[model samples]
Target: MSTNLTSETAAPTRVALVTGGSGGIGRAVVERLARDGFALGVHYSGNKAKADETVAAIVAGGGRAIAIGGDVAEERDMSAAFDAVEAEFGGIDVVVNTAGIMILSPIATMDLDELDRMLRTNVRGTFVVSQQAARRVRSGGAIVNFSTSVTRTQFPSYGGYVASKAAVESMTLILARELRGKDVTVNAVAPGPTATPLFLTGKDDVAIAGLAQAVPLQRLGQPTDIAETVAFLAGSARWINGQVIFTNGGLA
Candidate 1:
């Protein structure tokens, strides 16, 4: 749970820093990257125990990983986390900004503090992490940012949250253009109504079932489904840059 890492440097592998690795989609991405033989930095904000659990899962599966605690919203913490990755794994090859916040409310009644937190964590945090990743990630490496399908659905009570993700989508496009000659790819994955804890909260079973049925796929998306898309973007998907790959199973 502490920042003190387990000092058993394994053989060299692709280095990845996955912000919010303790959560559902993030955990899936971490496991997939580990399976791809990457040395992962499991970044977490508060749930160090969950992050450590993620790391253990990878290590137990013959993969190497380390858990680091830091606030993704703070530039200092973002940079420090990247620095840790560089120090631990020589240099970062991939950065996935899956850290985000979803506080839903109508714009008329939304609290400014909640809005600020969403913007700070989901928008500013992504920019801070991606900006650093843009500069430090090795050429031929990739940067994957998380966006939501709500940006397409335009649902009620999700105004602020959708706005933040929209910013991520836009920023990712421009970032890909800016990282043109670096051989680094920038893209966003916009998942729709995934069956993560973040998506299940505050909803009854019936409501959740109805929500799942609304999707054309006829079921809520699993984290692995999204992780598979991320894996493709990370490896061997060269020339597929600057695009938002919507992994929503035809929902979007």
Candidate 2:
């Protein structure tokens, strides 16, 4: 399937539903997927305006997309969101679970509520979404889950967040095995200190500069950087399943 975002030629490449499509990384993934010829369902939790902006951008550019509001942690919301996608496009071919929360605090002082929420959305949410994708998406479909580099390099206040992402990584591997012979690839993408909102918070210019300097690339990662890897995993690379491909610019 192929479509001209700028009206060169418009053909439906495939259909994708990207959870958290309103956020920085998710937004880039949604745009890249649309450019790759996939009709999109841009899902958001509490950012309807941002999600609408994403849909409008895609449509205005000549690609096809729709804004969907739902909570990733809720099965009913996910079912409805998937139904919306099937209604617009033909069927689901790719599902990217990027809806995650990163409320950081020292383990010793971390609030239980924050931990619970992160696990529910990041870990459990991944399971439910992947299950649905496995059952409903076409045979050549794919499911990409998000992990974090904190699982590789320990950070001071990122214990809870890292733990949540670790669970995602674990489940993705098993899901790949369980889907044997289904022709659907399951994988996880782990990003490092990206320039997204989650990484830029509560930090001054100097701090961000220092953080960037820590990486060999001497800068934070752009969302498109990660999205490129996601596109690869979702495309014709069936041999690369059940792996955590880290796109950290050498930070890991």
Candidate 3:
């Protein structure tokens, strides 16, 4: 009898490892990818509870997910995290670098220490995770990084945060060029005035409303808004590589 190879036997499940998967936008990306039918690695920095919660929700929705935690800026931590996902999910097809920190201060008045802290997380963390992803992500996969729309807006008090993400944008573009012929796409998503815990932490109602009004769409971006762009980049958008997509609602 001839052996019949079904499509299931020929193709394995696609896998995604999302850094900061427990946070607002990160969780949305994780859930969106899970619904897109990829097995997920929900990575957290220190909050295992949130990580586990994300995983549980994915599971409840009949999706496959596992919690992985580590400092994204540490090469060793990220290496181990990648190892764990590979062991659990076979291979990673997409690596999403959504783990980052933001500290707002005017350049002249900002504390250097706070700037350093933001850089360590936003820049070093991205570099470390990208290093692992460059080495590990399977062919025909994608590596998505995060930048910020403030880079374009030139907003005050965002000097530190914008500097870090500027590095990310530069690095992302170079990496995409370097990955040429690898069949792996690399890009960064720049979101503006998103209503996340990170964005809403210090801003009062007036400041928030002003930001929303600045957008031509007249609303603060939801996590899902950013996640939709990510979902497109991660699963399809084969032609859209080496570019930063501004996910803001016409913030200029």
Best by lDDT: 3
Candidate lDDT scores, in order, read 0.91, 0.89, 0.94
Best by TM-score: 3
Question: How many clashing pairs per prediction, in order?
Answer: 0, 3, 0
Model 1, C-alpha of 114: deviation from truth (Å):
0.6
lDDT of 1: 0.91
**Ranking of all candidate structures by their lDDT, best first:** 3, 1, 2
User: Which pairs of residues collide in model 1?
Assistant: none
Could you tell me every candidate's TM-score relative to the true structure? 0.94, 0.93, 0.96
Worst 10 residues of 3 by lDDT: 2-11
Error of 3 at 148 (Å): 0.4
Please identify which of the two predictions, 2 or 3, would achieve the higher TM-score against the true structure.
3
Off by over 4 Å in 2: 1-12
Q: Check candidate 3 and list the clashing pairs.
A: none
- Ranked by TM-score from best down, the candidates are 3, 1, 2
| Candidate number that wins on lDDT, 1 or 3 | 3
Instruction: Give lDDT tens digits, candidate 2, residues 122-199.
Output: 888888888778888888889999999879889788999899899999999999999998899999999988899977
Residues 1-252, model 3: lDDT tens digits: 758878877667899999999989999999999999999999999899999999999999999999998999899999999999999989999999999988888889999988888899999999999999999999999999999999999999998899899999999999999999999999999999999999999899999999999999999999999999999999879999999999999887
